[model samples]
Target: MPIGDRDLDGIIDVENSRLLSTYRKFGVVAVKGKGSYLWDAGGRRFLDFMGGYGVAIVGHSRREVIDAIEDQAERLIICHNTLYNPTRAKFLEELFKVVPRNMSAAYMANSGAEAIEAAIKIAVKATGRSLFVAAKGSYHGKTIGALSLTWGPRYKEHFSKLLLDVHFVEYGDPKSLEDAPLEDAAAIFLEPVQGEAGVRIPTREFMTSAERRCRKAGCLLVIDEIQSGLGRTGRMWAHEHWGISPDVMTIGKGIAGGIPMGVTVVSSDYADVLRLGEHTSTFGGNPLASAAAAAVLRVIEEEDLARNAERMGHRFSRGLEGLEGRFRIPREHRGLGLMAALDMRLRIQEVIPRMISNGLISTYSGLRTLRFLPPLIVDEDDIDTSISILDTTFGAIEREKRSM
Candidate 1:
């Protein structure tokens, strides 16, 4: 292995031997990225449709982010919250501009899970209740507190005892929320667009019902926008599509362009619940990450990337929808903005590697859905190229199956 890069075999071997087996391994050893493309150690370029799991909202290695990181790094990296760093203050000011008007305060953390953890604490303190309601097929985060809200059993069965008391309800069904036991609940958590459930977009009626139910039951509405926010869903926040404002909101993924950051925005109605020193993070709101996040906000506003996502997302959705008719494997396409999915009759495990081989990298939500989270900066040309890659890869796979 070298300083700047490593051979593919060496990189793979090192990761396989030294790292935990929690991650689904991919063969491409990516060494560099710029805009909507990633370059592997072997010098092959890949159209980054995955967008680093929606963390590259402004595209990889964006110059503004780089400059912000470097400039902040040179000046200062960490200034404890008690000291009040200007960079952290600046980041919060930028963040508040995009969130709901009632969301008057925020707590910054290092990842979505951390933000969710903070929200859990806030909800508990505000309502004095321990029970929560979350939708089935929901994914808030993997941390213990956040994982309690997540629906998948596989992720939390062993650690269930450490989790919160959360009741699961069917997503996109207003009746489910109405039937749910919410009187004693602190909050009802949900995603406007379910990403890990394969880009499931709920009906507007369902969202309105949730808000109504929360209000009637005296429970807070907590929206998890870790995957669907920050212009990825064509809107500043996915909740905008349904015209709902959450009492508490958790956002992460691309908040800092690439630097790790998570935020829990609390409405003024419940902002005073948490006392000083009741909950705090050692690394939260560090100047380095704050500076990068501030730059990301500026980029989103200056580039009008949210509108671009709306335009390009329609193009991408149409292309994926067209494939459903041409290929036997494709069953349907579902998505909003750049957050989209193609459901196939067959599992996409094998199809994933084949797409990588064809210079396209995608991800999956479940066994049969091919999830695409392209950069918001993606153009019509990028959408066409990705569609072409999907066509070629599916054609080859179908041909192989026929010959077999």
Candidate 2:
């Protein structure tokens, strides 16, 4: 049946009934998006700071990305890895230019989880080892293999038996990583910036020490950049900020301009470990995703979105910090580039809906942290508007508290 023929409310009801209750719904039925804003089914406009969990870096419905997708769809959409296509080849060449210089081979997949899964498989194949090390508060992906390396008890408690031999170390502590047993490890997975754990930024010393220890132990260092990569942190890759290189890197989210695409990039030394028949995906590196990815790279370079992310990030962070003084509230502001968080003194559950009601959209990390991931295309005006809405919401909440 045509989508237009179906009643929106009825469709939602059917979805709720048929689909597994895995995701927590937010009530807003987002129908469209462009640049830095979203429009709900009722035509209510919202300033989108959530960016679909960091997938809209280049902005929603960008013309270049949309054009590429449309043009590729006209010719071909899916061509299995069994055959080589021009768009896919060009995408690989463009992709390598932005990633670490040493990264030579890339295995494409459909999501961040698949990218982490590929990284795990390649690391294991290269080192012939089974154990892995990951940082506390790090989120890799939800798939069993990737979940094994992810460091959240809430996510792992139900699927404990499916996890692999993985050890957790304190983030931003060089001593912890240096002391971890890595002799028999295949790889140590780390996020350049822990995203789900409230946009935690690690110290330079910790990252450098981890790299050195990984080298010393001859273990593959896999950096998961699914949320922190592709200009989200004002750099092509977040690890670039610390001048550290990983043996393998998993990247996704915004890599293909919202198209479902993930990549595990491996250095030349370990690229051949995953033999031709050993690792493959049916829909990986297809023409449509490749075309979209290539266009995104071009736009990022042409528009210099990375530098914009840096400039705007500073402005936004400073604006958020100002709130603490104005409201006399205890808060902490932490971020790198555009990926930032505001840890409010009060619970965030009450503020999120209020912000939305006032025409702003954001997300929460943990219980009290409000995370902001606005599109790279966001301007000074957009930032200011979001901050204003936040200020009004905070003031209203405070007034209510005092009245009570």
Candidate 3:
């Protein structure tokens, strides 16, 4: 069912010839999108369970977001970061209202990594400490400061000298923090749910306990909500689930509905730590990105996407549960809200092709977990369709293996 640009293979060939070899493209060519589905180059539509790494919360081809972009582009698309912009201000105002308690300001950046860079700078400046704490299997971003916080060996091995002293702790274990030398650390950063680490969830008690420890020891609490925030976890912010607010919050991914944007929101006490010109981004608060973000925010609130995400996530989980081995996959499913990962113990790399053939899109992650981040705009019917396809294929695998 692929459409557009002659044929699917044609586009693949074109991409191979024209694009850089460093990046890989899936075999399918996405021609267009709407709601929870994307049409391939041959016009075959598949449910986007991956949701572009959980960025399109309102789904693809959203009218308001497109219109906002169109309108902004027609007016003023490119502007320097040195000056203030109305659209940026509007986004910040709306952002401040929904940001967790005590978050007083925001510093906009171009992506999640940039946001982390800003966050690390803020923590170091506020506390006058060089060290920060991050958890094993936690993903912050790929930039230097963010990469320092990222504990994956694949992501951090080559640049050992470039990275800083970010103590690694066991995720979901507050006792790790309790045992650490928190007094000298600048900040403790974590994701409410580890997305790249295969949708692992930290215990709420562990998170709250760490917050207490940070408070007592003068360590800053910085949450990398780039993936878990913005309704992926059903809650608007994943940290809200633990009832603890951070001194600084970094948000990206779905924040601007597929646009390149990230923001570091701060509490009042630490808001002004970075003075004027202390930290500035060239494309941070441009009008067009802000306009896109504003529209995305409105749609999220109007549609009550968080509620939808919560409801649909449970339905997806229940639909897939109790079949880890039955499906011939060894996954134990875990995640919060719509951000679910099915941890498969099998080599299982071929599951994705079989899934694509059955009209679904997903990706594998840490622990061999296949991550599912269906857009917030996805409905019950889409969920049902996806499960039906998944159920059929998984059952077939199990049956074929048993016969063998």
Candidate 4:
């Protein structure tokens, strides 16, 4: 039961005994990470493709983020929102410069779920409506309020009784939203690019139509950019791709350069829904997280990581598509920028582990899709390396299947 750099299996056993049984983890016990690579406890190196579920956009252990956090930790860490702090003020000022023009105010929190919860409350208080609508296959979060808006039977079945009144329509179909009863709904929650549901990108026409419909119905359009925002999709915001403005937007994951933070950016008209005392978080806009966020914004601007994501993502997608006929199942690529996925005809549960064994770490969105959220800082060489590893893994799997 010793915990000092034990074997992978031993560490996993120790984790099982001590941690809650909520996560399905891989065997690798990551000890360190830096810029698209992770080292296991055994000193084995892995080319990271998951990016900690898109939380490492600026790259793991970025120097700017580390320096900012250290500096802020030495100066100040937490201060109640009652008092105005310089770090928090600077972070908010910089944040406003990057978000959508319609979004003039922000509510900072600790995670994506908290941002979603705040958006829900804001929508309810603003419109005085009790019902909500979301797209099918959408994933907002797992918290009580967020989960109610999330549309997945598996995640909601056990906690069905605790959810609220939420109606779901087919994603990427404008007619579905038009057919739903959204006139009386408080808000319509959507992801610019559905991440957990396998990096589904909607059509520009569909997005514009949904925006028009929501405006006509007087329902707040809440765009959840938790996984797709912050330059992950080659733009400051994924909704920018469609040229549509949302009433409220929830962002997290990589907003603070891997530090945990969530922000609900709201339009100026609806910003006053949550009164001063109605909604507040003790650590929402603390100095450390705000400092990290300010540093993240600077890094994204200085490094031009969003443009890199666009170029690398296109190259990676083409490489994946090139392997279409070489495997037992055809590989179809879909996504924008660094948030990409390969839709395989077969379940990728075993294939992902094989890729990990080959020193390339990845994740699967569902039974038949391998999702890739490589760091935005990745270069052409990194993309090539990942593609090469995938080619070998797919070839080996095909050979094994043929032998059987």
Candidate 5:
């Protein structure tokens, strides 16, 4: 169906009836997006701070990404991994230039979950161990292999019988790593900044400790940068903030500039563990996504979005922090480079819709934290506008509490 012809109600009804009821609806039928804004089916413009869960790294409908996609699609879209394609080769070349120097090999997949799954296979094959270590409150992905390492039982309780052996350690606590059993572990999965855990940032000591422990146990350090990489957190990779390098790294959610693409990058030492036909994906690194991703890399470097994210993120965080002095709602504000969040005193379910009604959109971490992932291209005006909307909504909610 044509996007313009579909009304909000029709689209909503079709999705609610036809799709699996696993996702929580945001109540906005977004039809178009450009730069830092989204347009609903009713032509309402919204400041998109959620950025499609950090997929729109370069922002929605970016000309460079769109042009790349169009140009590649006109010639070819899909070429299996068995064949060497120029676009795919170009993407790998672009990827290596930005990644850690040791990361010389990559396995392309379709989503962060696929990337995590591939990392799991690579770790096991490379280390020849059955156990793994992950942190508490960590969220890797929902696939079987990735879920085994994820925290929270709600996602894996039903599939407990199928999961692998994984030990959960306390995040940001070096003592926990020292106490955990890691002698026979295949890998230790860590996210530089825990996004789903309300933008949790670990201390440099903890990150270095994990790296040390991985070396001590003869296991690989697999950093999952799916949400934190690609200049989302000021740095190209969040782990760089701690000055620690991982043996294997999984990245997605903007690698292809909104196209579905995942990558499991490995160091040169373990590059050849996955032999021919041991692992492969049909649409991984296809011509269309490869071209788009290559363009995304160029845009990030050429435009210096990382610097923008740093400057804008500090401004946005300060604005949010200032609200704590005037409002009785948000308890605290914490974040790093465009990935800001407010741990609210009230339920975020009531707050998100109000902000949406006021032409702003954000996401939530857990139940009380309002997470903001504005695009790397966001300007001071956009940040201020979002802050104003949040301030207004938070004030209104506080007033209602006073009345009650």
Candidate 6:
């Protein structure tokens, strides 16, 4: 509103009046962010546990990211896919080092959904199959190929007619996958940590067995690390902890330090499957996005955010467990590293608005899980502050129930 310098009062009012109501936005209009805090138009500060939906792994408005964006903006922004871009090439070269050895090449996309599409294309092309097998309660993305693999009845009921054939077996069970006749299947998609399905952590045995079975059956293995990637879970990539490397992997959300970027890395064997003109994106490998992504990776590496996340995550998990003793409503606390979720008896209908009113925000994996995804750079004091806010809010709800 005022040269993007903390004046959102007038901007939000005008936006509400004219823009479409797709998202149920919070009342406060955030103007700026740095480290793990954000300020609204009224200069109200919020300890950003959300982190742009787990996008700001290295923290908000990081100097490195800002510098990269500025440098790229001055140089060149967008160009067609027909020509090569310097930043994009550099980003890919850096990306290849962190990925599994099997994954040799990558395709850049503008968002997670596009990466999902690319993964789907690679998997299908590799195996020459049309059917996909996924787990129930897994969220790949909102695009057609991704949504096809998603297994929520409520979300898919309206779009049933528009979906494709995706067989979903129970999550955290490898027998279902092993027993299946998968000769005609393209890939078996799994999210190492089921972010939307309540941060469900599966056993390493389950994942390893699933990978073995998929490989044995000649079906490509695709892991969606969109929400769980880039040190959110104490690892460069979430799949690394499982000891199973996917033939193809999708990464986004935190790839570019809150800037927009998505990636689909594939093994060299399957990488060449996608023809020159088969799939392409206009903004997929833009200098601005790739430059930001490179900066994000550099920050995560230089700061050793992965190790920090592991240490802080254990501390936070223990703290949460202590709180659970007092509250006793949430059924479980689970996740890896900084990515954690609580299985709450309180449904989303009641808990969401309550948390928001208390000057805090949380996420729901299903109707039950209250997800806690603090930034990787979030300090111990901020963790304490967030827990205090939640404890106060939960106590109020308990008091109201007692009165009722």
lDDT values, one for every candidate: 0.92, 0.90, 0.85, 0.90, 0.92, 0.83
Pairs clashing within candidate 5: none
Best lDDT among the predictions, by candidate number: 5
Instruction: For candidate 2, write residues 304-342 as lDDT tens digits.
Output: 999999999999988988887798443888999999998
Predicted candidate 6 versus true structure: per-residue lDDT over 112-220, tens digit per residue:
9899999888887877788888998898887777789887777677787877678887798877776666677889889989888878888898889878888788998
Off by over 4 Å in 4: 7-9
Of the two candidates 4 and 5, the one with more favorable lDDT, higher being better, is 5
**What's the candidate order when arranged by decreasing lDDT?**
5, 1, 2, 4, 3, 6
Q: What is the TM-score of each candidate against the true structure?
A: 0.98, 0.97, 0.95, 0.98, 0.98, 0.94
**RMSD to native, candidate 2:** 1.5
The residue pairs found clashing in candidate 1 are none
- Between the candidate structures 1 and 2, which one is better when assessed by TM-score? 1
Q: How far is each candidate from the true structure, as Cα RMSD in Å?
A: 1.1, 1.5, 2.4, 1.2, 1.2, 2.2
| Candidate 3: regions farther than 4 A off | 1-4, 17-25
Model 1 weakest 10-residue run by lDDT: 1-10
**Which should have the higher TM-score, number 3 or number 6?**
3
- Runs in model 1 deviating more than 4 A are 1-4
**Judged by TM-score relative to the true structure, which candidate is superior, 1 or 3?**
1
- Estimate the overall C-alpha local distance difference test score of candidate 1: 0.92
Better of 2 and 6 by TM-score: 2
Please give, for residues 165-264, the per-residue lDDT of candidate 4 as tens digits: 9999899998898798889899999999999899999999888988898899999999999999989899978999999999999999998987889999
